[model samples]
Target: MAEHAHTHTSTPSPVPDLNRNRLPTLFEVLSRRTLPPVDLFSFYIYMRDQQRSVDYLDFWLDVAQHMSLCRHYVRELRRSVLVGTPEPEKDSKRSSAILQGLGEMSHHAGPSMYATEKERDQDAQMSAFLREDRPGAHDSPQSSNGPRNRPSPGISSSRDITSDSNSPAHTVARQDIRASAEKILYTFLLPGAEREITLPGSITQDVTTAIEEFGRDDPEVFDVAKDYVFQAMERDAFPGFLRMKALGNLIPATLIMRLILGLVSMFGGFWAAFILIFLNETRQTRLWLILPFTIGVYSLASYQYSLDPILALLGFSEYTPFNFSRVREPYVRKLLAQRAIMVLAVTILIDAALCVLFILVPGKRL
Candidate 1:
């Protein structure tokens, strides 16, 4: 009897049904397959891989170095404007242009130029003092012997025994300060080939005006402006690495949610189908009978979810999986492709539904 049953099973069915069903679409395949864990793994791996790249490290370092340079330049420029010896009137045209540029920069970046509110207040006070109209407010009164009553605190006093000269120590201090100031100006004003060559001429004029206006009251303001500029330049120079860093900062939260969702999605469908089959056991006989149905339902749901409008709105696509597949390593692409079929399948279904709705709705309206 067993042999007869085996022989019967071996015989082909009367109707040729082999080609009756179409292969599952991409969306269907994605939806039926496992999901949550694989999705989480992909997200984690992407972030980890980016962190390990040398470009990420170099980007931040470049920014820090540039910012330092800017701070130094601002400091020097401010000092030169304040106490450094005035350029000869013959060079006034050039000085005027430079000053104009500095002034504009300072004006535009006024808030950043001052280190603190206290510094800004001090500057305001100094400006008020300088602008006072009282005669001899800045100059010391003359004594009966035709000498100034008291040397300005800013000037040096030289007590020379051999010659009746002013204080050499004060003169030396002023000279040293002036020399340091000049070095800073040279570095800040002349960026050489590093800066964009096509900047508007107005930029120079604006920066010069800002420097003159702000530096007149407080030299530190220039330092702040210079630092801000350098930092901005550095950010522009290495955008990729900086972007990676920002992404990295969000990795923990992104990875956790992605991982949990992927895991739940991957196994949840199969379990749900099992429950349904179990509940229907009175009507159906075999324990293993529901496996195919469960798989089909899972696949269908996954495909639908992949094409969800919400995900699409967030710049994600079911066909694209994690959206990093094209940019990622080949091995990662393969892994995601293998693991993400079910999700993709669901997405495609949802998208198809939405597309149909859109078309039908528009036609109905017309």
Candidate 2:
């Protein structure tokens, strides 16, 4: 029994060690053609979390600048766009003119052309039926066996394709899909770019307008899209400068600094409270330490809440789980600032009340 116990104690456990799984390589991502749009969005977020997206974007930007602006390269790119010609010249006219002319004429003539053709074909069939009949046509004129007496099954009918094309439901569905795609693109590929440039709804519209103007032709689309993106970035640059100026203003800066320093005080106060309570110090001293610590924590939270609008403006909202937007109105920001002050005051009052309770009930500190 002693030997068995010693053997059991010396033996190692057979539990497996779990390692962190690696993300897919760039090559692996690029090689898979069947990946869904959500996967691309996930990959983008992963790249951002890993802090590699910034460098990747910078590299691409440098490459784009070098490839797009050089005189010879630009000319070569234009030449490439103009090279392919599956569409024959008008003089060569690969498409049949007669068929095109008939289709065009059908638009104006309506269903009457079909009616006339149908009547002529019916008349020919009637004549053929008469030729094959026995010479008793007048006798069989009212008979069910006669071709003329029979109902014509060859009557042609046409449906108006134009009506379906012009339907309100069809138009609305197309618009909805387009809007959804734009939102997805902004959320996944170009996160925060829209907020920095324009308001949430307006940025996609601006991008669509740019595409409309420049995307009509293959040659101009890339250059125009690149320019529009840069233009948006430039627009945000001025506002960021203004924000920096606002941050420098002494009154606001002082408030922000005090709130920050209060966080440190909160840390120290927590430790002091813990020591006094656990080490059997006087109840009054313990209450003093705890009250300031509680007030400090609440104030710090309120301070961060007050800066939400500013953080949203700087495009940090995309990283958050829920939606957040910048308060474009100056009045709204002022209201939030006032609310923050009120919250801090409330927190202090609550802490003071708690301290009074602790004093009144000395045995109930826990």
lDDT against true structure, model 2 = 0.32
Q: Tens digits of per-residue lDDT for model 2 on 1-366?
A: 222221111112111112212222222222121121112222233233333332232222322222212211122222322343212322123222211222111111111122355433432332232223213222211212100111112211111111111112111211222233233234323536432322245544544443343221111222334344444433533233223222211123334765876678777775665555556667766667665667575656445543333342343222123333232223323444455455556766766765555443434234
Against the true structure, what is each candidate's TM-score?
Answer: 0.24, 0.24
lDDT of model 2, residue 104: 11
In terms of lDDT, model 1 sits at: 0.30
lDDT of 1 at 69: 27
Q: Looking at model 1, report the run of 10 residues with the lowest lDDT sum.
A: 158-167
Q: On a 0 to 100 scale, what is the lDDT of residue 364 in model 2?
A: 27
Write down the RMSD of all candidates, one decimal each: 30.0, 28.7
lDDT of each: 0.30, 0.32
